[model samples]
Target: MTYFNDFDINENIKKAIKEMGFEEPSPIQEKAIPEILSGRDLIGQAQTGTGKTAAFGIPLINQITTAPHVQTIILTPTRELAIQVSGELQKLSKYMKIRTLPIYGGQSIGHQIRALKQGVQIVIGTPGRIQDHLRRKTLRLDKVRAVVLDEADEMLDMGFIDDIENILKQVNTDRKTLLFSATMPPAIRKLSRRYMNSPVTVSINKSEVTAPSIDQVYFKVLERNKQESLCRILDSKDPELGIIFCRTKKGVAELTEALQARGYLADGLHGDLTQSQRDAVMKKFRDSSIEFLVATDVAARGIDVNDVSHVINYDIPQDPESYVHRIGRTGRAGKSGEALTLVTPREMKHLRSIEAEIKMAIPSHAVPSIEEVVEKQQQSWKNLITDQLNDDEDLSLFNALTEELLEQYEAKDIVRSLMKLNFSSAIGESDDGYNFGETGGAKGMIRFFINVGRNVNMSPKVLIEEISNAVGIPGKAVGRIDIFENFTFVEVPEDVAPFVYEALRYSRINGARVNLEPAKPRPKRENRPRPARPSR
Candidate 1:
């Protein structure tokens, strides 16, 4: 079971593996393949980029025959992963001439129907699309022998659990089912308990969950200034291969466009990409042509690249585990890498959670300055020039031209002009000038004056607890409390202000109507004559 050759795989599958240039099996494949080929249900706990597709795919494809019905269904969380898994399956089944179809939303249903009519042995699709096909009766699971759920946890996160349950119900309970996820959440465990029978559980250790070499870091920045800060960091780090993680597909597209407009060789990877488009983008990324890849969490899950130097979190991930996975792209193969996360003030709690889970403190760092970016660029150019000088090449013509120019102008002048031409134009506007407003700094606290005070039987402690319970703000961030006859004033962190404001805007406090607004500046107290030098 340590090798794929140990299994009773067909010749065509072996040939396909050989053609695909896969000789040794990955750890997951080495362990899970044999169990799956033995017709046992499996629950694999492993991260993406671990070759889980082949672990489940090879056995499933080997089981597929010349039957016209769909014998295997692979469900993925996103459309991009669906197409990617289907393409891998097709490649793995190439020698057997197995027919595989990818079905997902945002595509023509009629086309899917036509392809289904043509008889696909395997169908890879998303939950919503698969449910649609099931409703239309365009897909049949009666003959299905194997079902694979890739990134099952992600599917649950997207609220597709019900659809997944329905799809599993449609499949034969006696058939082999495989569920793979990075983390085993409670819901997934419950599903396996209910649907799978005596399933063999294979768990890859968390140390091996992601590349250990990937260096991870996070930065706290205002949401409005995230783009500017990201550009500054990228300019300063200047990664040869990098990826920026966003939350949505639209975010990917927009960020990719913005990066490209600024002269970076970047591209978007998301569910919207066609198979061919995805291939092109990955090709560029692999060939070192594209330096920046903007992608969502699900779309970028399966990407395995060794040369990536940095990973940027454009949006603070919803979960701490996702942050780990997103940054695992870099620092691979014993290489030192960098990861940066852009977080807003409100999201600091999430950041703290990540730190608590990882058991490591991510040191806070300031965004790079424009001058630093220019210095880094110049250093890179200097390195490039040094390499060129060291290379054995015919530079007689260039040397002669340089000598001629040196005679007309001083060498320093010529170098200065050349540097200006090569590097000055590349320096972009500095992000330091970009204002995220006063809401960014901790100094800017939200001030709200309440109409309940000592006269109305109110204390700061009660008011603090009430506001905290009502708007979800902790008491620690609630600043100074001032009590007056008719009103009380309190300060909250700026980031939490908007939410507290909206929550209390129309709500009554202590059964009395209240008003919330920016706190008025406290009037300066004047010193009266020291009590007439008094009674001392």
Candidate 2:
């Protein structure tokens, strides 16, 4: 289908599509929608950012022209995706009086029960949460006319396959079933054979799994310098909108703080935050109030945002499938995007695995030096000046001042002075004032006190690994580890102290309860000469 208007949809659906500014249908939508509207069981294999939501949502909403009732159920792998699908369905049905309710964990069940009592035509939810409602008899699906399994492969990885089967058994067997996944793994194939009745398979091209317009590259850096490398990359690229992926919640928080401290507009999103907080953070990201959004993979599911110029992988994903999902957030629609990944020397094997999975070689690049960063900044400044000059504006009031400045000093000198004044505010001082401390000793480190100590046979190595896993920091960044009778004290770089404190506050060491707090300052100890730490 070249355009949504080419499809035989009612005026209400056309009106909604027009309102949403969707001119032409995507490849998946162009193929899947027609088959679905004709009552065929459909299976769509496409990436996340390929307009898959609207492809299924539009037809599903178009079929719902009756009163509010339980008719359609869309199962997602995560609560975030459930909410996202429900919102899109609601928007697509704006001209038509369709009601949708999203059921998921982390929200009040009482409110959901009340909404169900009032009535809902479509229910979008996670398999676990939906099963909970079914067991409680608060949700019934006997009248469901259609079922959708979105991101079926992800649900399998998350161990929701059993729950999905149970949920499917409750619905009518003659109903329509639509399954969508980025890959057609064996598990997905088996599930389709068991559930779907001769489903029509619609897959986007294999080469289309990742956007061709995206410039994908990786940066090789030492484990301890990941933060510094990310900062330098941002300074050089100067992305208009960017998202940084962290593997852990604590990492997201820490990296967001690090970027903000460096004067970048950034925010963090993770599972630890409440639903309202997640919503607020996403709203800011969508509205362009925040330039950088650091998030974990699970928390970022179902997030569809255009205008994202870059996606930075602060940590490599667990698998290549996940890499596709992360980079898909950018280069959406027909626009270009850039994806950069930071890899430690030890993680090169994992990088190679990702490349094999994607069936493409991601070239490695050296980290930008200070001189190169300075040159890029100067070019950016020149581009900014050129854009300002090209923009239409009345400059009559500044003509007199320009003439007076030209007479008082050389024009080149005057221009140079103006450039210095304007550019200084954009690029701050170099990172020469920060101290990273010694790797194995407590030179410029902050001591954190923990409850579990010598009684539990806790060693420095174990403590280091625990802290690194909990906070998503490299073990090399951790300093000395000292243990006492019932308490332990560990040293971390001064910059990472806050992140470690916050992560350890809710974490345990060696399966023992822990209460972590900042330790009192200790006297310096004599040690051999070591390299001075870098400045912030």
Q: Against the hidden reference, what TM-scores do the models get?
A: 0.64, 0.67
The top-ranked prediction according to TM-score is 2
Q: Worst 10-residue stretch by lDDT in candidate 2? A: 432-441
Residues 383-424, candidate 2, lDDT per residue (tens digit)? 889998998998898999999998999989998889867765
Global lDDT of model 2:
0.83
Candidate 2 regions off by >4 Å?
Answer: 274-277, 345-366, 378-536
In model 1, which residue pairs have backbone atoms overlapping below 3 Å? Answer: none
What does the lDDT read for residue 457 in candidate 1?
60
